[model samples]
Target: MKDSLIQSTDSAYSYPLLIKNLLQAPLVSAPDQEIVYRGDRRFSYREFAERVRRLASALTSLGVKAGDTVAVMDWDSHRYLECFFAVPMIGAVLHTINVRLSPEQILYTIDHAEDDVLLLNSEFLPILDQIRGRIDTVKDYVLLHDDGPVPDSHLTFSGEYESLLAAASTDYLFPDFDENTRATTFYTTGTTGFPKGVYFSHRQLVLHTLGVLAALSTPAVQGRLHRDDVYMPITPMFHVHAWGLPYIATTMGLKQVYPGRYMPDHLLELIDREKVTFSHCVPTILHMLLKSPLSRTIDLSRWKVIIGGAVMTRALCLEAMQLGIDLFTGYGMSETCPILTLAHLKPEMLDESPEVQADIRCKTGLPLPLVDLRVVSDGMENVSRDGRSTGEIVVRAPWLTQGYLKDHKNSEKLWEGGYLHTNDVATIDHQGYVKITDRTKDVIKVAGEWLSSLELEDILLHHPAVGEVAVIGQPDEKWGERPLALVVPKAGATAPVTEKAILLHMRGYADKGLISKQVVLLRVRFVEAIDKTSVGKINKVALREKYLA
Candidate 1:
């Protein structure tokens, strides 16, 4: 009986969670659903499936086979969306290149990924031209252009993206394989050292898609992402699969609009034109939209946006709420396939004031279903859920990347204990909401007391004069490190917003015991803009080098 239980049956069939499976539901149920790419093109899901197959066939004909890597350097567009499915479906890994990286970094990633085939947009030709000789593994190039004639290039081109798709047959078979096969890879934008490549498996991605769907659909009042919603991704598709929403959007058969590049006016226009109901981005993008002159002219009331990739301040949340936008925070990193928690409101808390709701909405939030999240101390003990005892966030989930690609040392550090360490310091409330205080390395230590840089930044953001703010620890002999703030004043403010004025405002909070009394406003420098990561999160590492260094 024991042997029989362990043995496989001849009649048994195993189902693998491949990317191809994700296409089935949408094809059958919403075949006619529309997919728009900026103002240039539009196609139905029926056409989308055919295009995906054609793309797969084209790549296959060009010597792409199972286990090969295909790299793409393009803006967020329908072409990218097609590659997201087609490459993986053909049993090849998709490398979503971050075009915003420096030329050297771009070269490093391309070489490191060992990309076999590259799909290049005409805009990025200069970048390739600079490093063409150094690129080792890439054998073929496919050019992509949006408008006008495809410009002549020095690099050898196999064929144009559209022309290849047009000539290729749409009946190629996408074979089934082990669900654990690696599907996609992209380098993480780390502050120190070279960017680390984080890859996800087919099983991981499909599970992540399902996990996201369950989280969004289960929520009652706010933060629900449904089928009827028109979706657009402001988050770059190259970044953690646009926080993994593109897969979710496609799986749900939502009408997806791809804004080619993140221009504030263009994004606003697309939102107004497409009646785009849902989107996701980091805080800086939202701030940019609010600052745009065109934003005041558009109707943003119907837009539901998920803010991730950085700390979402209460000030920003309040401003978005005032505009009738549904904005909330989500928590994850590149290592975790990026969506672990979301700051969706509870049913009991629905009656709270907008200000109160905004505060909750900006929190790190509870764990998504099947996400085993814990805040742990140095000894690996779980921290108290008192909403004050902060610890490193360690997690165990089905979808997290096993480790960094080809970097065993960092991979072990990433998964030191049984759980994967997130390197973020956070606390949990009795109600199970996780609020991140600061990254483990970003905490400001003043006379042995740790102050959250994020907390200070949040407090500074409450000041009406401040448009955007970033807080970092400055070296100090007296106290180990002092908190320094860089602020950008709101546009059209008549009041003289000085460093002293902002310091005084923070001092008021310090006196009232609202924040740590140790957190005296040491200095505030008003700046025109804050530096951001490629994906739009505040680049505190860059600011530290500029100011504190």
Candidate 2:
């Protein structure tokens, strides 16, 4: 009830937090640290900075100006890293187009973002060829290719990416601007409608980088990312800035390796060849790595991975630990500048058994610095930190997306009560570690009891023959809804895993009172594969429509 505002002093210098400033520490301290692309190209941080400047100059030559939108559709490469800085540093908003989206969705986003210039990989040229004329706002294109002669394409390109950068001067100066100016934009992989645009400002990105750096630097021995650690991102760069780790990695000047497209054999090869110490990805990617034949031959003891974009099951955590890989869960959504919490262990908890540690690592984790996270009921009352009382997770942080671009109704709903609603149902323990039980929409109510589909999926994953599983609620005559699981079997399993075996597995947990007796109502179906979103999350929305509809 007091006036807490303070007036600015004339002599005090206000430093605006900008993306360009993040390069200062690394450039001064570790200029020679390397950034590698696949196994082919490598360059120092000093050269990386120079290339960023050159890229900005190239965009300028293409008539890119402050406030203009420059879009990119390419694989994860050194080129994408340059754009992460150069485009925003020069004051133009960078739009990281999700290449995995359907052609129509991609066209819709390109048009919706009003992209002025597009930099696309040659692999996606055919996709563009399919809908070239429908793309209204794009005036120019820059082609990105890895090796060999450039393939012929129908669309007119301004020039190739490296050629333009090579021809530009590295002497261009990046000017300072308002910290709150929009720096980047990308469309969210929304479930029901066309993807919604999420934009972040320069200030928000800077804050997010610092917050993530602090959280990952916590003194936990397992998953901490330090300057000496070699970095690779299993998450796609197009997805929430690969959960915003690239900036943190670049700021720290760590040795970075970019895998063009995620291939199991290649990723494992890179892990062994480059001695990759730290990386992050969705649960599906981790599963693929574990199932890869190369994973059996490689030494993964030195690797540390953070899993996000989906739940990290206990089975997956145990498998990684057995291979000496330090794996854990991180929690956030596209609306969050993506990292909100990390499942790192406390010093005292570090000595626990592997089973206990695996359970701890699979948790959603403790909130990062400057993040205000809470679980509240429908009435907006705070939920008890009892670990069993589930509620919606809501948070406020300097880096959270302000709102969906051009969507007033959903934006208001997202920011209701001044806290960004995560739409995830979770519980917090006395120790402040959060365990997400389910998405608000994914929680299944059976005969008046709430059953966590995530919980059931985790239990099913513990079965030896069950490779990957997704659980959804199906209408039942007796119970309001019953848990139905779609499962993918592990390759080369000695025995086939039937629905009866899966039910018996759940019944064992019910018999031991580990879960409710109603869990006996669970059903399972075998599937060839599970569907995934653009960012590698299990597409539960699509699954529900496929099986239950």
Top model number, lDDT:
2
Tens digit of lDDT per residue, candidate 1, span 40-155? 68999999999999999999999999999999999999999999999999999999999988888889898899999999999999888778688899999999999887666678
For all candidates in order, the CA lDDT equals 0.91, 0.92
lDDT value, candidate 2, whole model: 0.92
What's the distance in Å from true for residue 177, model 1?
0.8
TM-score of the candidate numbered 2? 0.98
The predictions' CA RMSDs to the true structure, in order, are 1.6, 1.4
**Per-residue lDDT of model 2, residues 405-454, tens digit only:** 99999999999999999999999999999999999999999999999999
Q: Per-prediction TM-score, please?
A: 0.97, 0.98
Give candidate 1 regions above 4 Å deviation. Answer: 1-8
Worst 10 residues of 2 by lDDT: 218-227
Off by over 4 Å in 2: 1-12
